[model samples]
Target: MENPPNPDPREALASAHRTFATEIEALRALDARLDDSFGRAVEMILGCRGRVVVTGIGKSGHIAKKIAATLASTGTPAFFMHGAEAIHGDLGMLTAQDIVLGISYSGAANELLTVLSVAKRMGTRLIAITGHPNSDLARNADLHLDAHVAHEACPLNLAPTASTTAALVLGDAIAVACLESRGFSREDFARSHPGGALGRKLLTRVRDIMRTGAALPVVRADTPIADALAEMSAKGMGMTIVVDDARRPVGIFTDGDLRRLIARHGDIRPLTVAAGMTHGPKSVAPGALAIEAAALMDSGRLSQMLVVDDGGLLLGALHMHDLLAAKVI
Candidate 1:
């Protein structure tokens, strides 16, 4: 049998573009409707000491989870609760100090209505994000954020398309506003996401990752080049710290120094660490953030750096590889 001809790729792409354009128009309509109620929603969330419990049914539930995740990661304490589960005893997760955000397109989702009523009885503030402001959920809510869209992107106008996007965007706006109102800092965000790359970049300090005490490779200024190499090898770091008589960092000798020394002369003993060392090599404060140290290493083309105190006393040493191992980079 002869095969049927394939559909035109350009036609398919054009159809997809039309869908996006329609939805974008709906989103614009939704954005225009944002008003005083949006501000009230943010205020209620900021006033709550406990978590923001986001509950929604159907497609709104998926958006709610994403909003909750964004809020939790960005300094606001929040979690998603399914509207159906709230009536099945999960309502206990909410308290008077908490705030509840309910999402529903029709604003009459039976599951969400039940949860909103329970929150009201518990004296928890309720914020509603819905397409219908006159809907039951909106009427009962302490604050109503109008998420109404002109129409759905779906040709049938049944599946959630523009309305879901509007709800998601509004949720993000709320989270961001609350974050700013609370003066949330990068360090504060790091505290909540300590196990992630962002946390490592912001929270890891030089003192936490540097080699300390005897583990640090150190030698006197007058130590022979061979002794410096031994110290470097013993400490397993590529560099050795050269200290003055006062035991403060004066210079540093590294594998590069040994290569230069050997290129100068085969004799190693007469060439002291002070003679071959680079004076005042780059150093960082013990309290410096690990990401700052990483940036320093990159910009300065340094493989290792000595950590020092305010008085310039050697506290420890840090290698670029150490930052890599700690996932700070």
Candidate 2:
């Protein structure tokens, strides 16, 4: 028994570089060959009344699944149906209103051909993505999208490397075209991905995280600066709201203000909060997005913000720490 020697790192690097170069050339060929057929393919998907059922076999099946997910997340209704399964029972997933997107570099996989036959019998429109335009799958398709690549990135030129890359990129382009045509918005994307960070930032409202009731630190303008500081400490918001008799916020005093006050007038025992409080503090409506509030606070260089009603009555407050805790930052 003998241990094998490590291969040369330079050789591995050279092989990788060659693979990338081959794939880049394949993609360039795909882009240059694009014509009115590409636009028509997007138009067909958009016009489809039912879901886009993506079907494929083997390696193309994995790419089909990714394409389905991208289309679904971007506002188009779509799902992947395995080509082999479709001939057995998954063909029921297709309907006359649905559009079939079949992926096969050779355009001659028996399983896909079976599914295509069934889809055609059901009157389902078929969009074929194949490297051979004259293949049976492409010739029989209602619309053909040629995914032909000059060659595979694999040194043997037998693996589905560059061909798969071309198909995946074509699918992505179709998804993006549909997304723009439908005017898919960030909020819409967030809605689809509610458990993700972007969703939390877009969907969280000011009222959801603002401290209200006893958690709020409130003081009258006439209150002593020492008492306002106590309120700030008690609420742990690093600030206190100075409100009028009607509960309308007239000013705000923060830890920063306290420091500036001590520097200006050392004898603060006789001073009122009004002397140190900032008049007309920034405020937001309770319904505003928490992310928007964060931006407002950032632009004003604030650590805390007041949430007020339309009548200017203080309802709640937000601390920078709150946004961080909620992961909205």
Candidate 3:
């Protein structure tokens, strides 16, 4: 059989608009419904002596997993337990000091009750994120967070849509509140995310990664261009810093400059490094973040740079490759 024609683009766009409008309204309603109960939930999680265990069935399970991850990443230690699996054997992961968070949009997921009851009996604290306050999950919970929405964005009103969005936003609110309450800083966040570009930006500094002292490709301003090129070749940084007699940086010469000079004339060995170098090239301090070094190199279209102290005296040297090797780029 042949397929029918697709709907009009205008209709498709209108459907998207409707869905966004419905979910946005759901979020506004949820915002109005917030009260001391929300604050109480944050307080319980903050004071937890053990990890927070989050669990749910179906769509709520996905939301619960995300909430658990956000909580764990933002300073609260948390992990998700599958609701159905918890009854089989996964409940051993929970302890008396733990807090169990169960999510149920209808407030009556059967798969969640068995494990919730077990956690309750073990003296573990229970928090419920539910759509119906009087549902079984809520009645059994120590604290209830209402995630009720007026309607689903789904045309059939059967699928989880606005309700899930509300639940997710509420989860984010809880995580951020917990993060602020615990005094979580960017540096602390870096420790948890040490493999990403953000970790390099926050944790890796110029001094830690820059080549210092003898490792620097350096020469005096009046040094022969051939000698400057030799220093760059020896250091393998593709560039050399030109300093005055006082050891203060006056310019920088790069392989690109060499190529330009060679392209213009063949016998360039007689030229002084001062004549071929870019005077007053930008430099960064040793204590700066390596990401800052990346910014300088990127904005100036440079491959290498000099590291100088506040007095403009050469302290070290670095190249864009250094930032790349450190993953700051």
Candidate 4:
């Protein structure tokens, strides 16, 4: 195949600018026209006891899929069902307890109309998002969200650009409203996205990443500095906890302390661990978030922090490398 001639860069840039302007105008119009129906839609979804089944066709179908994902991740139980597939056997996924949110730019797609019809017969409530308020889907719906745009962003005014953007933003508005109404929190979101970075930050506790048992470098306050150094090297944590008889952490000594001790006084072969250990070592509870521990370590310029119980009994130790290994930093 032969290569086509490149379009003029200025003309291409102008076309891009026009598209952005049209979409911005459409969103502004949508924001101004939004009214009580939006609140009503949120109320209906919140009152629902089951899932929200979002359905659409063609370009509207793409928007519907994203909206469903957004809703599901933000605390509203939802999933997308393609309009054509709903008629083919996917309709079994729908029930009277489910709410159907249908999207069609013209509100006249045969496949979407068919799905809405079956949804009505099943006694399922319907919410319609479309550019046509008087269209069949809107009229039959329990609530109608107007997604009408002045015109398409396409120069020919035939493509679905501005209208689809309007529909998508409207759906986001509804989902966010429901999310706030339900008191959805960051932890709730993290629970739904355990494999994502936010999940690691919010769901992972210090106990999950702290080194314990044989991994912890621990020593008695009166232990020889050579023994403390041996324990730190064996644990590979670059630090050792100086604990009392009750297993409560009272002080901490690090490689930095060792270097400072050497600089202050050469040949300290008789020094005890207590001679260089920092008193009142910082600590966090086992239940605290790894991210919180990371913050404390960062602000205090600490490489190690102790985990303890209410009675101050040391349970574990957190190294800076542990937070890095857990991807909490």
Candidate number achieving the greatest lDDT relative to the actual structure: 2
Residue-level lDDT for 176 in candidate 2: 99
Candidate 1 positional error at 269, Å: 4.1
Tell me the spans in candidate 4 whose CA falls farther than 4 Å from its real position.
none
Each model's lDDT comes to: 0.89, 0.94, 0.90, 0.93
Ranking by TM-score: 4, 2, 1, 3
In candidate 3, what are the lDDT values of residues 1-329, reduced to their tens digit? 89998999999999999999999999999999999999999999999999999999899999999999999888999999989888888998999999999999998888788877888789998999999999998998999999999999999999999999999999999999999999999988987888876787998989989999789888988898878888988999988888888999888888887888788778887888877788888889999988878888889888887888998888888888888787787
Error of 1 at 90 (Å): 0.3
Clashing pairs in 2: none
The per-residue C-alpha lDDT of model 3 at residue 246 equals 93
* Model 4 CA lDDT for position 47: 91
Model 2 poorest ten-residue lDDT run: 86-95
lDDT of 1 by residue, 187-278 (tens): 89889989988898999999999999889998998787778888888989898999977779999998898889778877777878877888
Q: All candidates' TM-scores?
A: 0.90, 0.91, 0.79, 0.95
User: How close is each model in CA RMSD to the real structure?
Assistant: 2.7, 2.2, 4.3, 1.5
Candidate 1: residue 311 Cα off by (Å): 3.8
Assess the local accuracy of residue 155 in candidate 1 as a C-alpha lDDT between 0 and 100: 77
Candidate 3 wrongly placed segments (more than 4 Å): 2-5, 211-225, 234-236, 241-287, 294-303, 306-316, 324-329
Candidate that beats the other on lDDT, 1 or 2, i.e. the better one: 2
